[model samples]
Target: MTEPKNLALRENKVPEPTASFWTIKVLATTVGETAADLISSRLHLGTQLTTVVMVALFLVVFVVQFRSRRYVPGLYWLTVVLISVVGTLITDNLTDGLGVPLAVSTGVFAVALMATFAIWYATERTLSIHDIVTRRRETFYWLAVLFTFALGTAAGDLLAEQLNLGYLASAGIFAAAIVIVAVAHFVFRLGAIAAFWIAYVLTRPLGASFGDLLAQPTSDGGAGLGTIVTSVVFLAAILTLVIYLTIARSRRAVPAKDRQTGIEEPAGV
Candidate 1:
């Protein structure tokens, strides 16, 4: 791997394999789907308008995130949530507004994600999230994140809507896929970085499915929680976790070695 820019920046990322990390990630993704749905369907923003507004919001938050000197859990997770919403809106516009087929959207996003990864790896010679110290790597990381959400949105809709798998069924399938990745990492010797990205991509769909399951009505095979209610619940969960992390950081209680997340100490970090 090439030399990193700042060791301190290295600590800002790379830890994502913990229970709390996964919990917050899942909550953020769930809110992403339901919140976007809320704005488009409930508020009647229309796909184009919603996309514009959400993209603008994401850029604002992302600018703040990019300018940060180190990891601020609130800023980081808030950026993730906004990007998730924007990503969902992008896919929704392509499939629902533009009359594009789900299969086609899925294929296109899959190709796009692969291309991003290919270029990222080719340029950096390392795909480890731990190495994201330079501006270039950070750009690649955010780009990869955007593609993951968009691709997952397309693929999830392909399975749940196009394939008629139902929300629960689709969520179950992706959740099971995540479990398999976990097993492969711990039991079957899968590379940690590979497993992390695979599970990360899978979680976008999995969390979205669960969001639909809770937000949709019984006729649509969901729990009838309503999109507004689901969004509030998930957003609440994310906020609580972020607060805890912030307090932990302030207390100097969050020891790097004790993070328990997927972060490993790489050389020169």
Candidate 2:
């Protein structure tokens, strides 16, 4: 695939895939599930109102994210956290508010995700996050991410609630799937891009199942942590990690003279 043209910045719009990246991503997914529950169920805002408020907030943050020239850890991850919540809300709306079956929601989101990827590949000739330097590519990247979260939510809930697998079992299943993907990528030489996206999609379900395992009551086969406690703990962890990432990125950045002399520093998490 060709390199993205007219690249005004050295860094990709998205962060590099690192251990920290996956850590924050999974944390964000867990927060998405529990925080949505906290707002809609615990806080008495109702699903419909919470969705509207969150969508508005997401658009506002999204514009800020789009206007940035390079990845800013705080802004970038804020967008991710918000999008995660929005995605969960979308799936919840489908199943709870609209009375749609979890299986149907899962199927619909999977197809939508596939369609987004198809169009993304057709238009850009690539689906690598490393290539997300332009607005159009970033748009596709976020669309794919949104669909993955929604799809994962449906699939996780279908297994945990509908099929009576329970939250812990669902978490175990998705975790195994992620482990298999890692083995394929590291040992079997799966393509980096494919492995990354597949694992990315899997993390959503894994994180959601974990969140539910903590947040739901003991009768529901969970640990009885409740949504508020789970959301607070995860969000705090996310904030700490993002702060470290921001500091690390600043320290890794090269001086203007180095940039002018064409000394390219290797990218980091």
Candidate 3:
């Protein structure tokens, strides 16, 4: 139902979302939570100041991302990483700074995300990332990304705080949910849009829970690895992987044929 201009595919385009895309997404979200904690708790900036600095960084990274014509792993992943931090901070501000309950924030963000999807679908007619060639679609994509992070933070906190599932258990639950979505998509012919959104939403909580598991104190039921250590370790790994993928993709780039025959694997791998 999308207009012809909106539906038109970009020649030589990279596939929109892929397995590697999700993998990197999960990693980025985890890094976001840990990194923000490192800067705030370890460095003693406090959440408010940290949020301001992180949002600025995210904007700078996004400018670079918007300027790129083709998918560049480093730039794209950088934007994701920064956005994750900013998103987490946004939720934290609402909950901790403004005294909004986690449940309320979660519900609010869920409604906002749904509204974003509705408007995006009504305007673009398709949510498929397979053919993202326009600025409008890209804008909607990032807005959704921001909301997903905020929603994930609230949901993760709700489970851990209200339900007392603990970080490890919460992470396990989210991971299992993601697996179920994957199975439903691959085995049961689930709609791609539904599967993608479900999985996308699940990754936020999964990453958040895992981040807490690594960074929380042993008294708090974590390994006590410390946020600084966890953030540094994950950021290094992500940077190395992004660099490798960038080099590899550049070396072996190929032309796109059609969705039927020329489907390339996702951007990460």
Candidate 4:
């Protein structure tokens, strides 16, 4: 049977979040944080210059992603990685460059994320990533994603810097929070959309902490791998997975719009 043209237009062009999807998500988040540090700190480009370069790259690849007919793993995840880096840079700019407090940045990003969701739901009557077949919906999805990353970056930094939790402790805290979110979803029957977005936001800090633990110096409590080494490893891992997914064509069109308006099946959702 032919798909309804309208529905088809709004079908999600991204792959369903899967095991590998989650792996890549966390890895990309790590790379985002460390890679941003590499360019700004080690490369001596400074935050402003690094932000300009990454944003330019993001815009270029984002155009490719926006124009594609369907999910292209390379382009899709490339956009994610770029946006992730850009998101980190945005938070870093506010906190480090402008001397804005992490707590303030966190709260501001949280509000921005909430406002974006409100506007998206107000216009579409749905916040479903499944409704992403339309350009407008895709726009909302990417906006939400950007906010989540920014929020995550701010929140993570707040915990480490202001709270004095340190990277490993911060990673532990976020990891525990993710486990709680999982418990809520599976045991208490938490709404899928709420759970997804919550966990999505939480993972940013968790991944950032992990990245810092690996990349920072031993005296600073990291493993001594350094940002360049850590970023290289994570990027290599990401490259391998993207190549595999591309060759495998792991993406699947959802059987239909998610009826539950909640969490969805990997293939159909």
Most TM-score-accurate candidate? 2
| Ranking according to TM-score, highest score first | 2, 1, 4, 3
Runs with alpha carbons beyond 4 Å of true place in candidate 3: 1-16, 254-269
Per residue, candidate 3 scores C-alpha lDDT tens digits across 1-269 of 34356444353123347666777788889999998888888899999999999988889889877756667788888888999999899988998899999999999999999999999999888887775677677778889888999999899989986789999999999999988998999999999988988888899999989988998999998889988888888888788777877876866666343335676756655
- For every model shown, what is its TM-score relative to the native structure? 0.90, 0.92, 0.88, 0.89
* Model 1 misplaced stretches (Cα beyond 4 Å): 1-15, 253-269
Clashes of each: 1, 0, 0, 5
Provide the lowest-lDDT 10-residue window in model 2: 1-10
Candidate with the larger TM-score of 1 and 2:
2
- What TM-score, to 2 decimals, does candidate 1 have? 0.90
CA lDDT scores, all candidates in order: 0.87, 0.92, 0.84, 0.89
Candidate 2 has an lDDT of 0.92
- Show model 4 residue runs off by greater than 4 Å: 1-10, 250-269
What lDDT does model 1 reach?
0.87
* Best by the lDDT measure: 2
Error of 4 at 250 (Å): 6.5
> Which pairs clash in the backbone of model 1?
17-262
